[model samples]
Target: MALLQNLPYVPDTVRGRTVGRSFQAVFLMVLVSVLLVGAFGLRLFQLQVVEGDRNRQLADTNRIRLVPKRPARGTIFDRNGKILAGSRLSHTVSIWPIALPRDKWPMVINRLSKVLNVPPDEIQKRLEQAGYESIESITIARGISPAQATALAEYTNELPGVRLEAEAVRNYPNGDLAAHVIGYTGELTDEQLKARREQGYRLGDVVGQMGAESAFESTLHGTWGGQQVEVDSAGRIISILGDKPAIAGKDIQLTIDIELQRAAEAALGNREGAIVAIDPRSGAVLAMASWPTYDPNIFTTRITEAQWRQLQGADHPFLNRSLQAFPPASTFKIVTTSAAIESGKYDPGTVLPTYPYIQVGGIQFGDWNRAGFGPLSFPGAMAWSSDTFFYQVAMRIGGPTLIEMTRRYGFGRKTGIELGAEESAGLVPDEAWKQKNLDEDWVIGDSINMSIGQGFMQATPLQVANMFAVPANNGYRVTPHLLKDNEEHRNWKESLELSDATIDVLHQGLRRVITGGTGQSLNVPHLPPLSGKSGTAEAPPGLSHAWFGAYAPMEKPEVVVVAFAEHSGGGGGKVAAPMVLKVLEAYFKADQNAAAAAP
Candidate 1:
């Protein structure tokens, strides 16, 4: 009261108004404070409960990562258990962008380049392929040598987000031997990944590109596994959270004989040709080779554009010549001879006047020899490869009958071998087919040319081998295959319903060819009695194509071999027959060696 008496005096109405304003201000301040407290409480509840799992996951993501484990591809082995394509322990360099930030890439990549002996641009390209912002690690280099791996490991402190991982990489032990049959593997394209995502194919997965490797892909590609790991700030794995062990692919056993394969490829050295050897009893491809081959091991890693172009050279080195088609030449006369006998037009004793040339539609079709043998019976005609005799027989048997016989011999269609897509369905021309494709009418000249396996008639070396296999196996047409004891091919063979007389005549004629005819050179002391037919097909703008198809042991044939020399100057007797002879000699010598080794 004394302090108030000292203060300035005010009227009763002004004092009441001031006191009321102060009380109002106090109440408004309390209300605002309560509202602010409620809002903060609500926000706290949202953060702790509503977004708990998501926040926890976001926090874990900064320290956790997934590491992929690649599965080991299947090992490919020959029938004798020799490894053809297998896998070996290798070290790969991988990088994680999270630990090595974008700004640090140039420095780390440069240091890595020095250690790995790799170009900076290549490392940069690999990073680009993996992407900068990706949470996953990227493979920069695979199959690094031990020296490079050691160097990179020693420099790990200087290079962040880099690691060396041990894994299995594809390896071809024999280098270029059996290259076509084993094929090659490469990383999958984006398109392949998208298409094969259901099969668990990832971005860096390696897959078969050709030959038996491609054919048996499903059996060779094992299931992939992975590990969930917790890592430090430097992207080094601190602990393994989860691990799924990789399932290795199953091993594959092929019908190929490595010894015979070596022999086939050696015999075809440096020549632009093909050689195929098959087991007549089982339809197993003992050996198949193509010249100008590349080392499939070269494709095990990242192949440069120049190397790829070199592989796909003008000679088409990748082409499996055994599966490609060309004219069969006089080797096709076997079909014509069968047609003639089957049609009741000629027999083994029936003789024909085989002149040097024949006139058809006022066109003179000359034989290989201007001065031909005056007369030849059926066996003599076959032994001498009388094109004129076959021409006369073809004209007598008619085009339809010859075409039917050709179809019976598995011509004009793919052999349905284990090798896929590369096999060609060679053309077998009929009157209707001629009208549809060539837009021309079939004449007697077509029949005459077809009789000798020329004039648009083509057959792959594999087909030619199969053709001879029929007579070799007592008239059974077997489907050619590479995998040993494949379930899908249990019923691959079928009887051609040929008469015993036909088989005997074919054997007799083929035997005479080896004994006294063009293929007489193959009658060496190292080999048993052999039977075969020689072919020299006319190829314009190049030399003639030489071909020889043969089987060993006139009484019981176990093997069939076909050799084709594309555009090689000379007769089949000189160029192709010798190639076949070399293969046969090697095969028999190996057999004899094995027998002698048995105690």
Candidate 2:
């Protein structure tokens, strides 16, 4: 009763308000704690479950990488299995810029420069390149010496990035002998990388740049292999995770006879032109030589800019003139003669009117030496290479027949040889071609000019050789081939239909040219009789470009050879014919040597 009277000063509402405040405070604290616990649980779940695999994969990628291991390049051999291009293991020095301390760069360069015999400034500049990656900082120097490699490895503790690596480099044993045919290889450029992206080649890869090397790049390059290496935190390789072994490239065997190639090259005797010889039956190119050549070995490793510029500036040294287009001069008369016989327009005994000069359409075309064999037969016309005689016949046969005949003889088209760049298709102007290109009308003068292999008529040395080969091969025109072993090139034969009488007459005439006429100088002394024709094409007020096309042993043909000398100014009999004779002598001598050595 006393306690109730004292409490009468405060209201029950105040007491109830105090109780509500206590409950509200407790509820607010509990809600805040629950929310904090849920947020912490979500963060832990994200770190351990949601993003765990992705982070783990990133870490693994950082700890390991695949590195390439180079495979051996294929070997190249001649028909006799003589090694022409081979490979050797060479050591090279490399650097990783990012791995080296910035302050130690100058010291490292100075040491490397002295050891490698390279200019210190060059080494320093390479190391200073900010864009260069750790893997590709060091440029190649002269091939590493044994002492230099030992010194580099010994100083590994001092030079962080410096290391020695073994690499295979292409070597040409014969130097410049078969430079054009053997070709060269070098490190791939950025443009080459872009071009070869589909080929699976990277920036540092090496690739063929010319000749047989380029023709068979895929087969020559082989397969690149690599190993996945597990590395520590410091990027030091701990172990090889797995490896894919490299597959070596297949060996290539060329149909070229090295001895004959050398002989052919020597016979040219510092002349600027080309020589091509082929086995008539097999179409295997025995020798194909382009003069003013370069040393392929210079490009095998790394060619200096100066050396490369010298080669590029050389006098058409890179020009494979054997397969290039040029006026066939009088040599193409054989084709005209063959066409005449095939058309039954004239027989060998048919006499044609001839003179020093023949006027047609206000243009008078004259014969060589301004002298003609008067009232000549077909054989006499060919022997003298009479322009007037052939002109009359060409006009009678018409241009279409001549064009068809030339095309049948492998003119106005590629020779289909394995050479990467061949220029067999020369101009065989007709009405359409003349109107489209020359913007003029075709006239009798043009036809007359075409008859003598002039005025827009042209042929490659290879085409001329092929033209001559038809008669030697008995009208079976086999497409000339440089690679006889390639499985992909099995179907390259074409049959040229011609009568035996035509071949006999033409052969007899060609034999006389070598024996007593224009090509007399081409006769081999005390050897089998060789048949050939001389050609001296006019070139803008110059003497002439000398040319000779021949096939040996008139009775039975074994090889067909053609030689052309550009801007020689001498007659084919004087320059090209003599060279062809020397080549024939060497070829027969080598053949005899081989026969003597045969088991």
Candidate 3:
């Protein structure tokens, strides 16, 4: 070291200083490295342990969702197990928009439009609608044919956002047959959805709108199922985590006989009228028909605005006129005939004057026969449908008694049929009702008109049939229903408050009506002796509504039929009576055929 220092002491001293500085720099770098490692470890621990669950939940919030799956609706069958309304297996072409590339909307739309055979503009419109709903999948097309659906499924890999979903759509096999009783379904209204939201009804659910569909909604609408799915950032489904399978609704059996229903519809022949026939013993609606009818199948699918508007026309084809009421015409004589006998003030044999014309309440009343036919028996009065004769009988029974009798026969009120809101509570105007509704006092003319099934008195064809049904059923009243297992009606039929004697008198009068009076031409002497009353009432100035209320197999009547024609110029004897006859023949023929085929 001395020899080196003697050679270059200053140079040696500088080199030593530089070496010391290099060591200091290396130590400083090592300290900084340790600090950086420690900071990174602390941050890693905070993310993995402290807030792991919260972050996981946030991720799921952006990815996981619940999708609703509609359950299959119930099947509807006729009395003989014939299918009337059923669900058809259908498919929907839908799009989960979030799964698509954000910038590739136009390309997706163009490709989807070609495959779906839909307009590109239409596809875009549906895409916009889906986006507005955020997570909701939008339906591009419904009722997709099997071939189309298969084609769609095959190409789905290329169309990531497109989906082919299986769905159940309502189907009516009989077209317009039993349209009124079967009713229709439509998309859920806001009011309907709100009412059914807790039961899993959503904004896009289909719901029953009228007739049996509405009355049996709970029985028909099964529990909906759901699927929980995980999706990626662009709404691409990653996996289906879990699912609740949908349970199908129970099948319902109706009391209608399809053959009878078809016959009843045929009898109307597209006329503007209604016909109702019932099994007197069970209060089962054998057949119910309203003319100018529409096919309920139109409503089964997603009806367009134009089609819906067509359904709501001036003809009111959607209305079930069987439950609608007009004047009962001469059919109401059955009520007067019974009420008088029940009061014990008159017997079936009691003589009432039949006149060509009579003056009462400052209004002149005339008989159908211009020539005066002297005194006729009470039973014969209904047979002849003599207005003058009934006027006197009504005066004797008084307004209060007549109203009570009418109500007892199921008049002035709904028949409590299964059709629900399709029913109308026909009015039976009394002094009070008249004063309240018309702001006019009741006069003798009102009573006179009501006595002959005119004036403010109204009754449904169902009520007319029911009025005669009481007599045909041996004085037992039942709540009419369409369901096979109608416990309410089965239970209520046990307790009826009607006199057997009064019913017998009604039978006698209605019997005479068929044997000798208006409906005589329809009476077949060999066919178990039918009994019925015919009526022709004023309507629409120059027109008249025809009515016929009758029961078959008079000894123990199994069926009661009522036919009514609106704004028809002909009399009940010509129009409604013949139509009722046709239905009766059809019903009896069906029974005979069934018995013959029973083996």
* Tens-digit lDDT string for candidate 1 (1-599): 89988999789999789989999999999999999999999888887799888888866877888788888899999989999999988888888766666888999999998877778997887687777766677777788878898888888789888878897889999999999999988878768878998888866788998887888988998888888899888788899999999898889999999999999999998999999999888789999989978898886666778898898789998988998889899999888888888888777678878777999879988777876677887778879998888889988889999999899988999998978588988889899999999899999999999999999898999999999998999899988999997635487678888877777788888998998999999988778999999999998889999999899876788899999999998899999999999999999998899999999
Off by over 4 Å in 1: 1-40, 97-136, 147-151, 154-160, 486-489
Tens-place lDDT per residue, model 2, 226-323, is: 77877654446789998999887788888888888998899886888989888776677888888888887776544677887888785867777887
Indicate the residue-level lDDT of 174 in model 3.
Answer: 88
Return the top candidate by lDDT: 1
User: Which of candidates 1 and 2 is the stronger one according to lDDT?
Assistant: 1
lDDT of 3 by residue, 58-112 (tens): 5675677666677888988988899988988888777766565567678767777
| Candidates by TM-score, descending order | 1, 3, 2
Over all chains combined, what TM-score does candidate 1 have?
0.91
Off by over 4 Å in 2: 1-48, 93-163, 232-236, 422-424, 486-492, 541-543
Model 3 stretches with alpha carbons more than 4 Å out: 1-54, 61-65, 97-141, 145-160, 230-239, 486-489, 494-498
Please give the CA lDDT of all the candidate structures.
0.87, 0.78, 0.81
TM-score versus the correct structure, for each prediction: 0.91, 0.85, 0.86
lDDT of 1: 0.87
